[model samples]
Target: MEEYPISFPMEKARTIFRCSVITYLRNYHRFAITAATFVGIPFTFAILITQAILPISDLLPIVYNRLRTLFFAAGFPPTSEFFFDLSLKLSQTITSLVLLLPFTFSFHLLAKTYVVRSFRNKNGSYMSTFISLFFTQIWNSFLVLSANSLSFFLVSFTFSCMEGFGFKSPNVIIFVSASGGVLYSILLAHAYIISNLALVCSGIEGSVGGGYIAILRACVLIRGRTATALALALPISMAMTAIEALFHYRVMRAYRNSNNITVIMAVEGILIAYLYSTIFVLDTVVNCLFYRSCKGLNLAKIDGLENCSGDDSAEEDMKNLI
Candidate 1:
């Protein structure tokens, strides 16, 4: 059998990420339009609605503004004090918590179509793939949210137990919280990763099971290369964070001088929405390409996929004999 990576090959992973970016660029315009139409406008409206009613609005960083200012949309209906407060908190919580999966749902078909065309060299029905991933993600969401809440609660409870046992020193509490939070973060991140892998695998394998089995299979597929994936994902994440911060600074400055409707903020919101859609699709493509590599699939036959493929027929033959 041919040797596979037992540890991450840093250089090869960079190459993989570069290729994914190229694929994204080729499909960028269409992807951006789809994102803005479905994900962008709706999310922007949600933010506006939430901010309008919530009296204490800084819950959202950077964009939060007072209701009486330019932040308020033109001609919004007036609400009673009780109703406005109730609506504000409810909308803000719901919008903040429930945004990602729904946005992903809107862009799923377009993303899968790009993959099927780009990697598989096949013309598959984008709508069908979108519909399938939609239902699959809904089921996956319950598992993910439940586990996250439970893990977080357990971590908090452990710290509470330590405090109860009289480890009441400030220094000790700080040490424990920092260390425990890091450990919890790593475990939760691992779970998140496999959950996404399961999502990609479900699309590839066309099996439902709410992505649970796919998550396990993905864990096996990703085995020694988790660090490789993270190495590639982190830099992009950092760059995106920097871009967001820069945009926020500009928006804050713009908000100071102008009381009229803010074009700068609107444009920033649209661009960020596009970037979010891009990142989600890019992550999916990366996992797909990596999974294909692990499977020893002959992807060279699939035009643009040549950049992503290797000669791994020997590994495939070995698996066949087994």
Candidate 2:
């Protein structure tokens, strides 16, 4: 039920960010290699699966046509039709990716938690971390995706309306794209805030659901300080965008001629995926920094933080909670 305050002022944010970058760099390097090892191999496997599916999907039609010819030669017309239908189904298997997105996001979150633990030597148990990752990723990804999709639809509709009103179509498209950028940036910042809140909640109360109040508070905070919140998200966004651009460029360019593109893409994808996960994890660290900073600012107003029995303090509260 706590309402988070407006975001820190831009100048103060910059100073905090400078300190954060140094803290991140100093902490991040120690885990950099290990995080890559743990996350990269599985990510490579995922990319290979992706690549295999694409070729398999493309070859399905040809394979189906050949099988149909053979079936016709064997004089079973209905069986040949079934083969054709099977081809369509097989070709569309890539669509299963939509379902996989949640898991993909989950794995990224899990890896990030381990990376943080590595930095702090916090003894984050793997199973507990994995559970937190699963819930955080599924919930955060679903909410952000829904928000972004709605924003995209609304912005696109507004652009269409502008065009209908005789505004230049290109101009309208540009404006909509810019607005979409802002919307996504803000929602992404909100997600970062909420996801970190989830982590803190889980750490404190042993349940991701305990984070709901904090996550709701983040929504209110973001709304009241949209520009500052968005600005805080800028670095994380830039890193992700850069990695995505590289991933697309390398994969597409390699696909133009090289048979080894699959291997290359698999390697590159894993690296980029880890890079993305690192940024998300770092965003969480930044959120913690922000939270502590805000708490410091409100010290005069708030006599003390409520005794929430966080993990570090739980052993002391055992007699009471029991």
Candidate 3:
């Protein structure tokens, strides 16, 4: 029920980022080992094997056609080849998420719990923290899925409404689509920021109410700090995107081109995956620091208010005696 200061400046966000980097570097060995074992290995093997067994190329066409039909039926203009490519990428991402859900709930969650504990310099039962994180992750995942679904529905509804309103020109449809895309991106980004903070809050709180309480706290904490949260998340997201591209180019492309996986290739893939995992750990560190900053600001505000009230009361007492 505590209130947090909503006016989080970009400068504060930068400081949090710097502190997170320093923290990661200071404990590099511990974090590296934990990330490599729990996150890197499992993520690498899961991605490599899944893509090997069920290549995205095979899934691309089906996803592309389905998207095409949906859009066209909604009275939207035919999209460019870029649309096809985008659909394929989205399909691959969804497939990856689905395949990695188990690891996400287990190994990835465990890594985050450890990172949070270490960052806070706290000692406790790993099993207890892990269990709390497990349930929190479940709720966070559900919220994320719901957000995605809502965004998709809204976009489709926009198209349908435009069509019903007789805005059938190709230019008009394209413009509307662009506007909708921007709106969708904004909403989705906010949802992700909230979800990230909720996970960190849940990890830190370890309360009996689990994710639900943490999520509400995140909402309150992030009230006016949306820009700061987005800024903090952007770098990590870009790094992860670059790593994914590297994986696709170096590992998946090689496998597809030669139709054979070499030992050297496997090692390179693992290395790239490890790099991704490190970024993931850094992301958790950043979130933890952001949470602390928000909480610190809230505490400062409360103290300031209490001091003002006490001063006013003392002034009134003095006036009465006079």
Candidate 4:
């Protein structure tokens, strides 16, 4: 509650990354190959398929022309038309999202379980971790989708009401839409951030709500030290964004200039898949970094916890509600 500036500095980030990499490296050979291969394969495939198909539902035609032209120039082989044809159908998106749901969710759960087991200095099977993570992810996904849907519906209704009032200027529309989008995005991000923190906290103390509180306390503790957290977060975000941009640019550039259409098509597909995997890896690192930050901090003495009133009556209340 005190007005202190919390910061997630670069130095802290670097320290966290360094320590985590060392830990990951020490255990990498033992689990890295299997983790990357077995876990990575389905995860990457699901992400790629979903990404390719999702936008097609309502956004494809707007960009289809560009895609067609880009592929033609990229030298996609004679049968490349089949790929484009596939993209036109709604089935691709539905299929991709469906296929990806299990893999992505499972992978997330597995990753968290491993991290948890590692922190406790205990061995946990990948399958067990995966199943736990899967259920948690499903809940999280549902929470997110429902929240986003509600927010969008409200925004749309608001816009309709505004327009009905004869306030239909382009400027008004843009402002309203942008404001609505930003608000929704912020709310979504907050939910994700809280859930993520909760995941880590739960991993450490075996309670999701405890994890959320821990994160809140850490954020409060870092109020004045926020520059440190920001330093850590900004560069990582920038680097990830740059990698994504480069991936798209290269693929587009290749499509623009290539002549051996078939060869180019294969390369594009591979690259697209690779890009998806890369994003996943990057996200994994980011989460690892966050966990590392908490790991290094001397937060056991967090003052906020003292005020939380973990009283027996509170537990009783929770049980009654349940």
Candidate 5:
């Protein structure tokens, strides 16, 4: 591979990334209020009505069966009857909406930050960004998120298929799953960065083409630095995963009563809603900062925010033309 000259304000960009995450944490109360109202409350209600409010035994049969089915067979579709039809006390439709709709809205809100922080400063109204993104950015993000989910499922299926052969052991399973998971995660993170950049380029700049073309353009712009980008991103992503897992384990153990699944789910919902509120902002803002550092560079300026120096001729040409 030919090396391309690239220069970016490494120290400054690093500061920006750290500062952005810090800023979100500092103001997390504001984000928490919104997430709690929308995501947390509804998710809690769904859990309470479907599982927790009832005795653990009531929900246990259904959950155990569902788990067994999923473990034994291919996973259900996103729109499976299994999701839509419940047999217990809750109305299946309302419960589904409570659990699903808020999350859908929340994702749009999260993705909006990619455009807001990239193009605007701290003083910008997050409310306005939420409104604007609902109309413009959400669909593209939906597509990208869907693609990522499908990709992950495919990777998981591939690993499962490999396991169907005579190659199954504890260490082997752990090693293969961890290795494949990391690779898949890194690739997905890159795609997410590109997808968000595509949305920003189109929404902010307006001439960057729409939909998959812009996303592909983003791919072209980030061709060389996948591993480097992952190096920066993976730490944060892994940290989020670890935190989520730790909390989950703690909650599960603490609420081990057989009749408390809803209570556990409700608590987890509140925790996750708040965590995601800040983390999503952190993720979108940091990735945008990375994209901006490489914004006008000629090389596929990626991952090397601190070490990306390259030809200015292409950048200058773009500036002149724009």
Candidate 6:
């Protein structure tokens, strides 16, 4: 039997994360070059072009008004500053997603596939994996969208019920809104995590039910390890968020203020994009390690059960002979 070294222990999220960093650094040359070429440059250009061509600032007010209308109709207070900020952030995110959809479906997917294949030491064709990942991403997008919809529906329903029961005070509404927002965040976070793991499963498993099946497997594998998964994901999420903020400040804000894109600004933007791509590569590596850890743990449990069963059978046989 080939012994599977439990390099990534499920119990120690920090250890797994550290190992992932080590692995990425060990293969830094290959991962960095490939990711920079296929992922970073293209994404940088895509973002710059999109921002230049379609300024999100122009669309922010439109989205804000739409959100305001929806909230007013939902009976939410008109003076909620939190809702206003949330609406703006949501609008910016939506605009960015729409603009970057092309690169996301193409170069980003290819980058993830390459990392997965490299980790597995597989030199096979990428066609199958790419196809599988394409579908998997679509399903993940749907799942995330559905989760968001459900969260909104639940919150709206709560407000409606409160109104129906005559609890229309501003304090009561604010309290309900806060509780509903917390619940919404929790649900969306889990959904996002599961969707990310599903992408990993599709890349590794290679089309064996990589769509809905991969999602189901991710949900199962993450059963007892949810906290570890969250912990492992936190740093990467924060790094990516910080990088985004940096890009906005250094690139977008500069462009907005000057109405000109200099060579220096472009270079800085590209560097930021490269850093973001590297983080994506690291995130993929971490997810792959996490998957292996979950599998190793599951296999260990099965082996333990088998050993116990064998011991019980031997004892029963001895008793029968006696």
Give each prediction's root-mean-square deviation over alpha carbons. Answer: 10.2, 13.1, 9.1, 13.0, 10.7, 9.1
Best by lDDT: 6
Per-residue lDDT for 1-322 in model 1, tens only? 5444434367546556655555455556544455435644454344333333344444543222343232123222233242244234334544454444453465454454445334544434555555545555665666566665565456456656775686666666556556655665676667666666666666666544224666667778779768766766676567655645554455544564574547767787566545545565566666665666556653233454434224354223223311
Ranking by TM-score: 6, 3, 1, 4, 2, 5
Query: Candidate 2's residue-wise lDDT over 1-322, tens digit each?
Result: 2222223456445544544454556555544455545664354345444543554465556655764564344333242233355334434432434535654665555555664443222455767655654565556656656765565456556655665686765554455556656775565566665566555444422344323544554554444444554566677768766765676576655766575558767677666767755665566555544443443332111122122123332222221211
lDDT of 3 at 304: 9
Residue-by-residue lDDT tens digits, candidate 5, 150-246: 6546645755676578565656655655565566555566666666666554444343344465566567766765544555566667765665565
lDDT of 4 by residue, 1-322 (tens): 1221223254445544444444445445433444444455456555544453455445455455654564345333224334355334324433455656666556645645554544433344545444544445555556556666566566657766775687767666557656765777566655555445445544544433242354554445344544444544555557645644554465544555773446766676565555444444434444544554445532112221221123343222212211
TM-score of each: 0.65, 0.54, 0.79, 0.56, 0.48, 0.82
Give candidate 6 regions above 4 Å deviation.
1-11, 44-59, 121-123, 297-322
Candidate 2: give the clashing pairs. none
Better of 5 and 6 by TM-score: 6
Q: Rate the local accuracy (lDDT) of all candidates.
A: 0.53, 0.50, 0.68, 0.48, 0.48, 0.72
| Positional deviation of residue 13's Cα in model 4 after best superposition, in angstroms | 4.3
Question: Which candidate number has the best TM-score?
Answer: 6
Worst 10 residues of 3 by lDDT: 299-308
Q: Please say which candidate is ahead in lDDT: 1 or 2.
A: 1
Comparing 2 and 5 by lDDT, which wins? 2
| Between candidates 5 and 6, the lDDT winner | 6
Score candidate 6 by lDDT.
0.72
Candidate 6 residue-wise lDDT, 1-322, digit = tens: 2222233334356656765666667568767778756766676567655654554367656766887788779776678665666566566656777778998899878888887776443445788888888899988888978887787788788878887899888888778778877887788789878988998888878888588888999999899788878888889989977887788889888988999989999889888888878887888878877787676632111211121123443223222211
Which regions of candidate 1 are displaced past 4 Å? 1-6, 25-95, 99-104, 108-118, 121-124, 208-210, 262-276, 298-322
